[model samples]
Target: MEKNQKPLLIILAFFSIYVIWGSTYLLNKIAVNELPPFMLAATRFTVAGILIFIIAMMMGKSIAISWRQLKNTIIAGFLFLSFGNGVVVWALRFVDSGFAALEVSAQPLIVLVLMRILQGKKIQLMSIVGVILGLIGIYLLVSQKQILSQENSILGMSMIFLCMLSWAYGSIFVGKADLPRNHFVNTGYQMLMAGIMLAISSLLFNETWSSPWVWSSPVQLSVLLLIVFGSIVAFTSFNYLLKVVSPEKVATSTYVNPIIALVLGWYFLEEEVTLQSIMAAVVLLTGVYFINTKRKFMVFTRFFRS
Candidate 1:
């Protein structure tokens, strides 16, 4: 690819990651209405994982890895996909998809804090401000929901928070672990391991058989979209973005996804967006901006001071 085309491809990849992944929140909402949450996630990921594995094999990618590397990958996969995303899918049973997306949008802030503690990195002043702003945004997002009426809301939100932490921790682990050189193969293995973990957990939780064998077309379509576009395509694009762009730029999807989810939720499900949600969105975006661009902000601050 030419240098010019590289930029275009990166942009396209970012766009797909933003839109397709964001839409999965709404899809999860639709899916869980019929299928059980854990079971639904298990099926979606298992299918996506198998497809990715087949493609990786056809591409002559080696699935073999050192035992240590395989162990680490499985651990990361269970933490990130099985627990992190699994919690979000499970929470959609009680929360609006848009709100759930907004909740997970706080992952970047969580990551910064985790990085500080785990890697001994300095936390910038702007990142501190971002976390403050993000908390306020989260408060506004869930304050009015009927879901909050139950004790389960507290439990659900706690699960979502843990999910964020798990995902952040997984990202850190992935950065530190030694894995296969081929990204596709690594991702395929991770997804496969995560799918197995989720399925096993679903069985343990007695979430295995809640529904009829009959499938609804809407739910089936949602599952297909999630497997093909959300998991396979969006994840591939995201991996590509990590190579071509700055991690900060690729990380901007954290900010973009909630907006996409909110729009889709409003349009498709007629979910109401209040002034509070708008304000929360602004605060959340501002927080993410400050967190990601803190170095640039500090540079400008020092330049002006000089």
Candidate 2:
């Protein structure tokens, strides 16, 4: 943890949350095509949770938590993984993964607005501009005739939007909530609780289960990647970054995730990359940049006033 190494580690952590996490949309899209959504999600997380515990113990980390921490972890888990991630997985059944990622790029805007309402923080001029651009980008993306005309696309898009709210609020909550000191233990608890709930949800919805052995080669590989990198590595980075940086800074993963998803979807799955989508991605990520910019706005304002 030397000063030089810390910055490098932070950069590497950002890389994990950015590039690895960005690839998960395409991964989930592939896996969901062959498996039931909730069932797929249940299996991925349940196994990942178990693996996390095993790894944490092997590393000589204590996984103990008080009841209050357990309860809060469950709440955060449901908000982040169960509803936020699971519904997005479900929605991928209808919409293309790249398109879904494009829509989700507005996460910073949602987070910014939530901070304003919940914390009584005023939206600064830069963030206000970001919000306006985010809205325009979202409207352009979702309002496309081609997208809206697809069966269940609207439903899928609507559910994903709700999931974004859950994720945004969860981001805000986890930054301030009492939780386990070890990021590994905290994430392990969250994943375990979230997985159990997702398993119950899958059963309640009557989704059929199948053995991973019978899954297609591509899907099996995708699930393995989702479990190893997406759930364990990337999410751990996410939890760590939440502690080390601003929540909105951690959320900047949304900025790069869509681009990675778009290229992977188009190259691997032959998913369409429409012109409108590209335009929307540009506007959306630009707004995300504006929202994350820290102090230059105030400096510029002061200069103008002077």
Best-matching candidate per TM-score = 2
State how far residue 299 of model 1 sits from its true place (Å). Answer: 13
Tell me each candidate's RMSD, in Å, in order: 4.6, 4.2
Segments of candidate 2 deviating more than 4 angstroms: 1-5, 296-306
Model 2: clashing residue pairs?
Answer: none
For residues 1-306, what per-residue lDDT tens digits would candidate 2 score against the true structure? 223336655777889988998899999999999999999988888899899999999999999899999999999999999999999999999999999998888999999999999999888888888888999899889988889899999999999999999999999999999999888889899999999999999999999999989999999999999999999998888887787667887888898899999999999999988899999999988888888777743342221121
Model 1 earns a TM-score of 0.88
Q: Supply candidate 1's per-residue lDDT for 150.
A: 46
Summarize candidate 1's per-residue lDDT along 1-306 as a digit string, tens digits. Answer: 225435555667878877888999999889888887888888878888899989888888777888987887688678768998887899877777787788888888888888788789898787889889988887877786554774577777778889988977776676657766666777777778888888898899888454434768888899899989987788767655544444445567887898889999899988777788888889988888788875543452231121
lDDT of 1: 0.77
TM-score of each: 0.88, 0.94
Model 1 ranges off by over 4 Å: 1-9, 145-147, 209-213, 239-249, 295-306
Give the 10-residue window scoring lowest on summed lDDT in candidate 2: 297-306
Error of 1 at 133 (Å): 1.3
